[model samples]
Target chain A: MKALVHEEKTGTKGLSYREIAELEPNAGEVRVKLKTAGLNHRDIYTLQRHKPTDPPLIIGSDGAGVIDAVGDGVSDIQVGDEVLINPGLGWKEKSDAPPQGFEILGLPFHGTFAEHVVIPAENVVQKPQYLTWEEAGVLSLAALTAYRALFTRGQVQSGMKVLIPGIGSGVATFLLQFAKASGATVYVTSRSEEKCRKAVELGADKAIDSNGDWHEALGGEKMDLVIESVGAATFNKSLDQLRLGGTMVTFGASAGDVVQLNIRNFFYGQFNLLGSTMGSTEEHREMVQFIEKHQIRPIMDHMYPLSQFEQAFERMEKAAQLGKIGFHIR
Target chain B: MKALVHEEKTGTKGLSYREIAELEPNAGEVRVKLKTAGLNHRDIYTLQRHKPTDPPLIIGSDGAGVIDAVGDGVSDIQVGDEVLINPGLGWKEKSDAPPQGFEILGLPFHGTFAEHVVIPAENVVQKPQYLTWEEAGVLSLAALTAYRALFTRGQVQSGMKVLIPGIGSGVATFLLQFAKASGATVYVTSRSEEKCRKAVELGADKAIDSNGDWHEALGGEKMDLVIESVGAATFNKSLDQLRLGGTMVTFGASAGDVVQLNIRNFFYGQFNLLGSTMGSTEEHREMVQFIEKHQIRPIMDHMYPLSQFEQAFERMEKAAQLGKIGFHIR
Candidate 1:
């Protein structure tokens, strides 16, 4: 099987396309003949920071495929079933912590940037029928993150005001859609005017320039919830824009993590800063159902064949893509 | 009326004992002849930072007194009634934000540090009969902050592992009592061993040295909730000690507010950092009832006459007191 394998945990330069030994389903697992795979910033972090002591790794956390085989005692799912991988392994239900042995796909274990991947049978949910193969491939990681941050943590409601900062990423796009579909007044910010306009076109109530004064741009409309993945550069500003007692759910910190915060203002304003990651399996299923229910579709930027891995990496490195960048795997 | 006033916004040195104009009750307000007044860090902040534009400002937020007079339309409270001033004015009910014109007492308006303090009638709750005047005077601000942090934001539960960092402050002392009364396994940390020992004597399950390695001391017992008031120095360490999805409520930052945080760890752990301040009137009422129900006594460290306020402030500045410092007012 062909896979995009990193020989060393360096940077994109360490990535190479080569033939690797085909994987097989272990007990209670299923072999997925992946049709498509998606890129995420986590993959970039794993490449740049994972220790060299770590084993050679395949990178990718999201994918859609058909199951080729099922291992012993795998009774719920059958071979050839269309499914979406729940990327987050071992967190089967809602819990305060992910279960021991929990690892997202594509780090310690082989991931979807390969022709075939074996995952726990339980990690695969029947893919939402309304989504295309490309859409399903890119939806899980970003959609689940947005779902948990908005619904599970932020508790976003129909009339609540929501703000999504740095709105060009796959997760931010999905957040904009999910919040809009839920009847929230969605406000978005992006460094790129093009992305802001795109967000407004996709039902965002307002789109503001990230480089501008957000407080001035929003014009006194404070957010009840802020989905903040952009760190240091925008974190304090995000804090400033929340209504008293409002929540900011932070899942990623792409720019940097060193944030300057006035503890006095935070407490006096009564803010909640919640940290979130991937969702539980239950939330993953609900995310798929929610997208289906709202007819939500992943905003595709571009797709490349598995062979053009460097091109995909280059596009993401420049952040030139508006939405998800994918690889046609099969 | 005699009052402890800060004639300028220049730290504790600016505070002076002086005779000020006697205050009169306004429409829908009452004038209380303060019997005892408690010192809070917030009072210090006001003295140190609030503009001199509000000069001759009386300084103190927590007090118990006999209502000396009531203005017209003041129906719920009457003259000569004993009460504890809520301190947080204009926020009469639960709100995501304080009502317009919301302000803590002792800032722009004359506050409890004076011989007579005038406040809105709704801001006074009848003092609990079980409490000593000293206890009632010191209980409102700190107890309300702790109540909102633990029960309102932290959502603490019976048998949950709770950690209170920097455990010698008025609020930390009340938090320890409140959590213990609610059947929680309360753990405490303080730079001073004597304070830790005092916490244990007051029913804390364990007390650790804040300067020591807390993770090793706890022996793998992760905290479900952390009451964090010590800032910059302990914020990152507090994040490290919380169990996944745990909540940390921060209401003060005596150490400083600038702190280094690893964003990856925060989001991956799915922790919550909630910022709280003095609570609403409803919560203040609830706090008073809770104390009465539990028969919890406010920990009194020392007391001085109103003229010795500078010495009291010195004791607090040195962090020498284990609990609350109060002034015996007339």
Candidate 2:
């Protein structure tokens, strides 16, 4: 099987595209013949932090494909069933936190950046028929994150106002679409005027320049919920735009991590700050159902062949893509 | 009628114990002839921020007394009914937040420091028979804040490990008692060894030195909920003691207001930081019921006559008291 392998000696600079021994399903596991594998910021981090491994490592967190074979003790899912992988490992159900031994796929174990990957049978969910292979492949990680942050953590409701800062990444775009689909009026901010315009085109009610005064741009209208990914640079500003008793949900810190918080202002304003990341297996299932119910499609920036993994990663590293970047694997 | 008054000329330096005209009930209001009034940090704040008015402000928030009169349109409450006032005005029900026009009793309105207080009929709940005047008088503000922080905001439950920092304030002591009553294993931290000892005697499972390494003291055990009021001085350390996806609720900032937060650590650990203050009228009623059910008593440091108001305020300002301070008004 052809795979994208990261070796410690070469690190990210020398990612190799070559043939590797194919994997077989073990007990309670299934082999997926991946049709499409998605690129995420995690992949970039894995590349940058590559460590020595005996046989090199395959890395990717999202994929959609057909189950090629099922191992012993796997009865519910049959071979040839179309499915998408839930990358979160060891988290079997919805919980406040992941259980012990929880991890994401593609780290210690071989991941989805290959022609075939073997995973626990329970990690596979039926791909929504309404979505294309690219959409399904890219939907698991970012979509689940947005779903939990908006509905589960933020408790965003119909007629509520929501804010999304630094809109252009995979999660931010999903946040915009999901909040809008849930009947919330969505607002987005971006450093690029083009990204702001594109966000508005993607159903954002208002798009503010990231450098502008958000409070003034919103005419002093405060948001009921704010989805924040850019951290130190925009955290206080994002918090400032929230209404009294409003919620701000965060998944990542793309810009910087350390931020100064004013405890007096926070308590007096009666705000809620929630930290979220890749969600539970139950949330992944719910996200797929929500997409099917809304007939939502994942936005794709560009699809590269498996051999062009470097270019895809390079585009993500530069933060130039507006949506999910993917690999067209077969 | 005698009242403790704050005038612009004298401020907190010269809070006067003097005569004032007695208040009368208006339509939909009731007048309570106060037997006891409680001192809170808010009273000190009001005194410092005093402004000139035709009539000086009576500054106190918590009181319990017997209703002396009821106005037209007030039927449920009657003369001779023992009652305690809910300091939160305009918050008629429990929800995500207080409604517009919400204000605590002490600042803009005539508060409970006077011999008589006239409030909307709905602001009064029946005083529990189990409580003495002093206990009921000081229970409203601090107890309600603790109740909301632990139950409504923190969602604390039985067998949970709860942490209360700076555990000697009026609110912090209530948090200690309430969390213990809820079946949680309560831990406390205090700068004063005597205060820590008192907290353990009040039912805390363990007491850690405020300046010590709390994680080491707890054997690296993490808290499910943390009630924080000490802000900049201990905010990061307090957050560090929380488990992944744990909740930290804050109501006041006694130290400083600003603190540095590492956003990456927060999000990756999946924490919930909530800001809460005095609770709603509904929560006040519920808190009273819970107190009665648990037979919980408000911890009192000292009770001073109305003429000794200055001494009480001085004790509070110096942080010398371990529990609620009261003015024994007649």
Candidate 3:
């Protein structure tokens, strides 16, 4: 099988596209012949932290395909069933958190950036017929994250004011669409005017410049919920945009990690700060249903053949893409 | 009428025991001849921020007494009804937060330190018959804060692990008692060994030293809920003690107001950081009922006559008291 493998733990220096031994499903596992796979920021982090001593790893967290073979004891799913992978492993239900030993696909386990990948049968869900292969491939990780962040953690409601900062990422775009689909008044911010305009075109009620004066731009209105992924650079500003007793649900720290918090202001304002990450298998299933019911489609930036993995990664590294980047694997 | 008055807004120098004009209740108001009043940390904050130009402010938030007069349109309660004042103003119901124009009793409005205090009739709740006048007077502010933090914001449940750090203050003591009353296994931390022992005696399951290794002390156990008030000094340590996806409710910042937060750790851990203050009128009523149901009583450190206000403030400023400070005014 052809795979995107990394042999070193630092940088993207050891990344390569080459042939790897094909995998066979173990008991309760299925071999997915991936039709397409998606790129995520997690893939970059995995590459930067990959251990050289570990086996050469194929890395990707999202994909859609058909089961080529099923191991013994796998009864609910059969060979030739179309499916998308739920990247989060071990966590099978909605919970306050993932249980011990929980991990995402890829990394220590081989992931979706290959022609074929073997995973636990439970991690496969029927691909929503409404989504194209490219959309379904990239949809699990980002869309599930957005679903939990917006609904589970943030408790966003219709007629509520919702804010999404740094709107170009896959998860942020999903938040914008999902919040709008839930009848929320969506506000998005971006450093690029074009991206802000595009967000507005995609159903955002308002788009503010990330570098502009937010207080003045929103006419001093505050959000009921703010989906925060940009950490240090925008954490305080995002918090400032929340109304008293509002909630801020965070899942990523793309800019930086540590931020200074004012305890006095927080308690006096009566705010809620919730942290979230990848969704559970249950949430993944619900996200697919939600997208289908809303007729929502993933925003695709570009798709490339498996051999062009470097270009896709480079585009993500530069933060130049506005939506999901994909690899058309066969 | 005698009251504790602050003539200026810097330090405690301007705070003095003085005579003030007697107040008369207006329509929908009642005047209470206070038997006792409670001193809270909010009094100190009020002293430090009070404006000299503003009318000399009586600085106490909690009190219990018998109503001596009722204004026009006030019919539900007659003179001689024993009552405790709910310090939270304008917030009549429980919701995500208090409505606009909400404020505590002591700053802009004249408050409970005086021999006679006039307020809207709605702020008065019947004093629990089981409590002493001293207990009822001091219970409102701190107990309401603790009730909201532990039960409302933290969502603490029976058999859950609860941690209350700096367990010597009025609010912390209430938290220890309330969490225990809720059937939670409560852990307390204090710099003073004596205070820790006192907390344990007051029904805490464990007492950890503030300067000791918490992880080692708790035998690697994590808390489901943490009531945080010491602020910058204990913020990170309290957060570290929480289990993944646990809640920490903060209301005060006696040590410092600002702290550094690692967004990555916060989000990945899926923690909930909530900011809460005094309870709503509804929560105040509920808290009173909860106290009565559990047969809880306020822990008093010292009781002084209104003329001895200086000594009481001095003790509070030095942090020498372990529980609610009071002024007996008969």
Per-residue lDDT tens digits for candidate 2, residues B67-116, read: 99999999899899999989899987888778889999988888999899
Ranking 2 against 3 by lDDT, winner: 3
- lDDT, candidate 1, B7-77, per-residue tens: 76588777888888997887999999999999998887787666766556778888999998999898888
Candidate 3 at residue A147, lDDT? 98
> Can you give the lDDT of residue A35 in candidate 3?
98
Clashing pairs in 3: none
CA-lDDT, candidates in order: 0.88, 0.90, 0.92
Write the number of the candidate with greater DockQ, choosing between 1 and 3.
3
Query: What lDDT tens digits, residue by residue, belong to model 3 across residues A176-222?
Result: 99999999999999998999999989999999999999999999999
Query: Which whole-number lDDT from 0 to 100 does residue B87 have in model 1?
Result: 92
How high is each candidate's TM-score?
0.95, 0.95, 0.99
Clashing pairs in 2: none
Q: Of the candidates numbered 1 and 3, which has the greater lDDT value?
A: 3
Each model's fraction of native contacts: 0.85, 0.87, 0.94
Kindly list the per-residue Cα lDDT of model 3 for residues B15-116, writing each as its tens digit.
777888998999999999999999999988898788777778888899999999999999898999999999888998887789999989988899999898
Window of ten residues with lowest summed lDDT in model 3 chain B: B8-17
Q: Is candidate 1 or candidate 3 better by TM-score?
A: 3
Q: Per-residue CA lDDT of candidate 2, range A75-173, in tens?
A: 999989999999999987877888889988888789999999999999999988888999999888888889988888888899999999999899999
Per-residue C-alpha lDDT of model 1 across residues A1-330, encoded as one tens digit per residue? 899998764888788888899978989999999999999888888787666667777888889999999999999999889998889988888766577788899887889999998999888989888889999998888889899988999899999999999988999999999999999999999999899888888889999999999989999899999999989889888888999889999998888877777777888788888999888998988888898899999999999998898998888888787889999995
